[model samples]
Target: MFKSVLVANRGEIACRVFRTARRMGIRTIAVYSEADARALHVREADEAVLIGPAAARESYLDGAKVLAAAKATGAEAIHPGYGFLSENAEFAEAVTAAGLVWIGPPPAAIRAMGLKDAAKTLMIAAGVPVTPGYLGEDQSEATLTAEAARIGYPVLIKAVAGGGGKGMKRVDKPEDFAAGLASAQREGQSSFGDPRVLIERYITRPRHIEVQVFGDKHGTVVHLYERDCSLQRRHQKVIEEAPAPGMDAATRTAVTDAAIKAARAVNYEGAGTIEFIADASDGLKADRIWFMEMNTRLQVEHPVTEEVTGVDLVEWQFRVAAGEPMPLKQDEITLTGWAMEARLYAEDPANGFLPSIGKLEHFVMPDGIRVDTGVDQGGEVSQFYDPMIAKLIVHAETRQEAAEALAEAASHVQVWPVKTNAAFVMQCLEHPRFVAGDVDTGFIAAEGSDLAAEPLSEMGIEDAAHRLRHFAARSGDSADSPWHSLTGAVGFRANAPTRITQAVVVDGEAHVARMLDDDDHPMTRLIGLSVTRVIAFENGSAFDVSAFARGGSGAGNPASDGSLRAPMPGKIVATPAKAGDTVTKGQPIVVLEAMKMEHALVAPFDGVVGEVGVSVGDQVVDGAVLATVAVPDAR
Candidate 1:
């Protein structure tokens, strides 16, 4: 095996690769941009190097810089830990040219499956069943329209270089084909530097199932079963499970066969995933599955496959790169238990699922659950990168058990100081159809509201009480206060009624949270408000936390914690702090950018910065804390 390796990506995936590399006694090198200098991945690596600025263009995505980091660190191999340069054939070629092992497929295989149009042609020639569509090389608008007409209505105009759903569009009618093609081509060119596209038949009620295939240079390959990636939002996978819930023997064999054929056609090596779009309108059948695309590196959802296969893909990558043959054959590989993975992102389910960015205040990973996280509490969720906060995976004896365990595990996971979809993921698992394994790509969009409802229940009182108690404790007041009685106790002090405006999720709808009158106690809570801005956990049926006193003298309530606004869901690109930095309100503490846009989340009110939690370039979700401010004492 190679003595050392370089991980060419950041975040949970980088940390994940390092974990396996460490277990195998392989020295791991981590490369980061200026923004991620203090990221978890950097801290976890055996050696680290700075690549460039926070922008991926200047850093992570810069293949040359990554190659240099590998060479400088004397890394025997470079592992593009998915995303960034993972699938870039040029990067793989560059890594090998730099005299280091590329822990991925050969450039020949990557190039063969790199472009959608060409890959489809290869698949068709390879005799793997393919969805009938246009794979012509014409770039003219008129030609694509003509092709769409030939394919019939509801055709998918996908960028030949597309993956992660970017540069792909579905047109239901001929009239919309032109615009969609144009959009797809533009996004494709911008995203992949390839503007070519292909037209495919859009299957209604499609179930995404991908086969994990590993090949060694010894011309041996084996399939690690399948993963159901049907649950998605915005064409991006949200939940994935291995050993597909409803998979049968015959169909599973057919899908696996086609996946292996696709791999063998390219002479694939290392860990690569073959995604197939299954037509579930009439239920899964061997013949109904068609090739989608090949993910030429480790997937974000690889953990699910690992949970079932008991195989460490990273270890295999190292072994394969070091000129090793397949240790096991297809017959020896077996799927044990069912596993599910949910990608918890910092996004607002209520607000059209917009990405949320902020700093983590209370960052705690759930116990008994496998959580791969990069940022800690006080880390900035910047808009500079993907908004994914963590991947929560669980395993069980059966699909039902796995589903239940996944829900329970998701419920226990928490990442406060920012908004997350953990609660929503639990709700999705409990959704009627999801529990029945009746899912599709439209699952999140169709039953989204019901699945995204974050009901607070009768615990707002308790949540508020907890917050109040914490406030009181911080202010050196009695922990046991009459918070329950004090809730909504003020009718109209003198001038105007107390006003509290918040957005709540009720039955999947965003409702204006009106300030409740003193006697208008319905008892039931809404949104995530246990009573009213309070919190209740799965272990509690009733929560009654005392209200915090102002002014902190044990007589009045403390002032509200200033709101920490998330610029948008992205990566934290930069910050400078050492815990003792005295900062005033509105002082620039950190620079956060999201969606290629930048913003500064400064001190909300004049106070000393009590904690500088995050460093430059950390991924954050919405509503996470960038820093904490300690209000000054009265003169």
Candidate 2:
């Protein structure tokens, strides 16, 4: 085993690898950008090195800086954890050429599977079933459109060099194909520096299933069953589970055998995943499953596979890098129980899932489950990296039990100030369709609005009001309290339920709440941000409210004003509307790129663009006004 290993990544995956390395008595090293100076992963490492600036291109993506850190720290091996330079073939070759171990597949294997079109070709040649698609090298738009016509409508336009849903789009008809192709190509160029794409027939009801395969340097490869990742939003997986719920023995055998063949074809080593797209219009059948793509490194949802198989994937990576044989043969590996993992991201489900960036004032993950996180209380979610804060993993004896346990755990997540998708995850876990194992790739898109419905009920308002009163009274003097003066401070029965009218502000809207002066309210979780403000947590969501002041109507800022502001700190990518341009409400005026996603700032009302404050490529902070519109004067 290597004496020391440096993780060429940041955030949760970095922390996850370090945990395993330490457990195996290996010294762990961490590299971080300036933004992650106080990050949890940095503090947990045996040795730390500063790589570069906060921006990923300047820091995490700088292969030279990472190699220098490993060299300076005398790191015997380098572990590229899941992202950044993990799948960069050049970096892998550089690590090996530097006389250091690379805890990943060989550069040749990475290059073989790096491009989707090339990988599909290789798989087809190797007799591995591949999805039918157009992989020709013609970069002309006309050629792509024709291929789409040949392939049929409702096809998927995927970047040949894309993963994680970037640079991928689905077109339902010819009218939408042009826009989808342009968007996919743009994202592909921006994300992977490749503007090429492939057209594939879209599966009506697709289920994403992938098998975890591990190969050692001695040419031993084994399979660890399959994981169902159908719960997705915007093509990004939200929840994943091992030992797919409805998979039978025959179907499992076929997928696993194909996965082994694909791995052997590439001479793959270390942890790799062979993803298959299944047409679930019918049940999971062998002939309907086709190769979608292969992830050349560890995956974000590998914890689910580990929970079920009782295997340490990171440990396997280390052993394989040391030229050791496979730890367990294919037949020795057993799936003990069901396991599920939910990705907890710092995003607002109510606001189109835009990344929420800020300090975590009251961050707390629920107990009694495995939580892999890189941020803690007081740490900020930076805009330069992925917004995922933690992953909640649960294992149970049955699939139903696993889903229920995970849902209950999600409901206990308590994050404040920085919004989270905890409530949204809980809703997905508890949905009837999800519970019945009747989900597909489009599940979230079809049910997102209902899943993110307004969570504050009447009972929540009343509970918040009563809590606000008690908090206000406690902050004030007991001898002379204005809240007590309102209630006369004279209650004959101490435990009796007394009715009182209390004024409270929920989300800046003032309300007079009639509450029983008892502690039996349904929503009891409350935290005081200030004397006048309190946050009530219900159903895995935080409701920020305040006590309504006397003679003061707590009205929030009007929403009809046509001010287009950046929702978070980011760089302006596009300004579609210029000054004096006539625009309608919900028109995309400015697009801000932050946290690796683009957000369109829309016009609040129909009006003429009065001013354009920022141009494309300008960086702006949260709430920075980018443009404004003036209503046409009615004469």
- Give a tens-digit lDDT track for model 2, residues 1-635: 88999999989999999999988999999999999999999999999999999999999999999999999999999999987899999999999999999999999999999999999999999888988879999969999999999999799999999999888899999988887897788778877889899999999899999999999988899999999999988788899999897898999999999999999999999999999999998889989899999999999999999999999999999999999899998889999999999999999887668888987776778889999999887788988899999999999999999999998788767777789998899889988999999988999988876687345544445544455466545554454443433321111122213312233333333333333345544322223311344354555676654323232323344565777777789888778789889989888788787887667778877889988899878999888889998888820
- Cα lDDT tens digits, model 1, 314-405, are 88888988999987899989999899999988876654466667666445555686888888766777767888879988888988998887
Q: Which stretches of candidate 1 lie above 4 Å from their native place?
A: 455-459, 462-635
- Candidate 1: worst-modelled 10 consecutive residues by lDDT: 539-548
Overlapping backbone residue pairs in candidate 2 total 0
**Candidate 1: C-alpha lDDT:** 0.75
| Model 2 misplacement above 4 A | 457-459, 467-532, 549-557, 576-587, 603-614, 628-635
Model 1 TM-score, 2 decimals: 0.77
